[model samples]
Target: MTDPQNWAAPGANQPGAPYPPQGTPPPGAPQNPGYQNPGYQQPGSPYPGGQYPGAQYPGAQYPGAPGGPGTPPGPGAVAPKPGVIPLRPLGVGEILDGAIAYIRANPVATLGLAAIVVTITQLVEVPLGIFALGQLAGLTAAPGDPADPTAIAGVLVGSVAGSAVGALVSFVAITVLSGMLIAVLSQAVLGHKMSIGAAWAAVRSRIPGLVGLTLLIALLLVLVAGVGVVPLVVLAVMQANAAVVVLVGVLFVLLSWAVALFLGVSWALAAPAYVLEGVGVTAAMRRSFQLVRKQWWRVFGISLLGGIIAVIIGAILSLPFSFAADPMSDPIAGVSIVGLLITSVGTIVATTVTAPFSAGITGLLYFDQRIRREGLDIELARTAQQG
Candidate 1:
């Protein structure tokens, strides 16, 4: 697909028509046109047909800024900016900027959603964490004998249960937040504001599908991992040579990771697809696969960058807390209730800021893909006008 930025803009560089210089009408053109593009002039009244600086609020995009993703690609190159981003194929910077822009635009809705979810997750996690840490403390203490079987069992059970619960909570939280955030973005693109209640309501009906999508993705990952794990299990059962077992395990680990990465990137848009297109889980998965077709690396690169940014932000925000409190992940550090509470504060802060931002990037990527493949920008532009 052609980059929208490279699309030819007519009269942008015409001969004998030196620019009137922006923010000013041309030397000969009438004031009614009131500031056409820098190098070009509209034949009649400005913003002749669609979204333009002439039609929008003061300080909005100039007409002829650039065209959107696809279809009926016309002059005024940029259709308009009804919301966080222009109705056009987005740049990496624009996508990142728009994600932050939405958060600022509806702080209560975006940040509040994240905070509530994090609270729910912590309500479950903190107790389990404390229990697990207590078990570790018991095991580490001098019982003067080999550890009691029951005590060992408790440590194993508590650690396993805590890990499972945390993973499950994170999966559900990400899915739910991502779906709702996409709903928020859809409206934001049309220049509408949303309350937390509105954001929840928009995605309420799609909740089941969103959860199912997450589960499906998780199951696929496990299945792919099993491809590696099964061989190791078999090799061990047969009393395979240690060297062979290690080599096989290493190769399978790499293979599984590669396969998982491939599938993860391909399906990264499924949550956005489910919310925005109002599709079922299977349909959304298919839609994502379709959108990512022929663009695997592009989608992967964008997602990787977004994930990296979120990780960096979380680490920075949580680092001070880590130093102040015993790190929760380190059972050896001995989880103090105080430490847990302090860590919880940092976790909430980081997740609140990062979750919505990451989700926002995915949502915009979905829009970007739609704009490129299906002329979604045109549809969005029309919707903005009607609204």
Candidate 2:
């Protein structure tokens, strides 16, 4: 057979025999619109007439672009280095870790402030401890003497007074220290390092406010205890039925204790607010209550956890000293000056270490709550970047 290319139509084999004229348009057909040509351009051919996908046509910004006007950042797009915490809503573990990190990152500020306050607390406590021991020595009745209720009462009063004084002093000291550490932690969260002097200077003006808040809390607790105990005391003195008085007292104490604990957690962030926001005690209390409103249980749990941890560690540190001092025995007989001093040393060490951690946890928890309730992480991120 002939090759296909060499073959021709029967009519076309004759020269130009009625073949279709080159490039002739078919009858009644419109001229070619040139739509199929590669170089042809149409209206809005590059983009749709209305808008382009993912484009902000005139002055609009691309969604989620950093630092773009009218654009919000994408989720987790602004994460910076861990200064004190990852600037986001935090888990319980993260909060705890952040507290530890605060200590590690600014030991001179956190630990040094703790040590100074704890040392002052120890100084106040040691003298009281000695005075209490002396008072106990006098309260010991001679072997033949009947139990002297008056002398016994004197000893009880002395012990209680000594404890109250020591507690008050420690409260003031810790309040001051916590305010300073909070200032430090706030700066740390913004990726700034603060010297001890700087931290103190930042918080110095707020110390009086912190003290006032501390006193208010203490007074509330005392009132709660008094309300729970006064009825029982009255009934006992009036020779009421012992079982009745005990039962009523137990119920009252339990209820009051629960209320006190709830109130305590509600106001736990007051110090941070007072120091950081430069607010008054009443305003700080209100601010803390507002922050903790919907997250009361969470705040309570974290505060209780921190308190338990501090107590456990303090007990562990004091265990050896407790054994040496034998405080359970007669204060006059078993306790020695050296043993008392050693016990104080244990307390000082424990307080020095745990105080900062507890304070830091509170401050960070405040920040975490703010980040969740308000978009504080954005402000913090901006602050971090600026710094």
Best by lDDT: 1
In terms of lDDT, the poorest run of 10 residues in model 2 is 33-42
Model 1's alpha-carbon lDDT is 0.71
Per-candidate TM-scores read: 0.76, 0.72
lDDT of 2 at 246: 95
Can you tell me which runs of candidate 1 are displaced by over 4 Å? 1-76, 138-146, 232-252, 327-333
- Local distance difference test, each candidate: 0.71, 0.69
Q: Residue 112: error of model 2 in Å?
A: 1.8
At residue 119, give the lDDT of candidate 2: 85
Model 2, residue 261: C-alpha shift (Å): 2.6
What does candidate 1's lDDT look like per residue over 1-387, in tens digits?
222212211111222111112234322435543433222222242534332333122332233344322123345444478889987777789999999999999888799989998888888888888877777776777757686889788778779988898988877887788777777776777677777786777678778878988898989988897788888889999999999999998899889989998888889988877666555677778878988888899889888899999999999999999888865444554658789888988999999999999988998898787665554554455446555
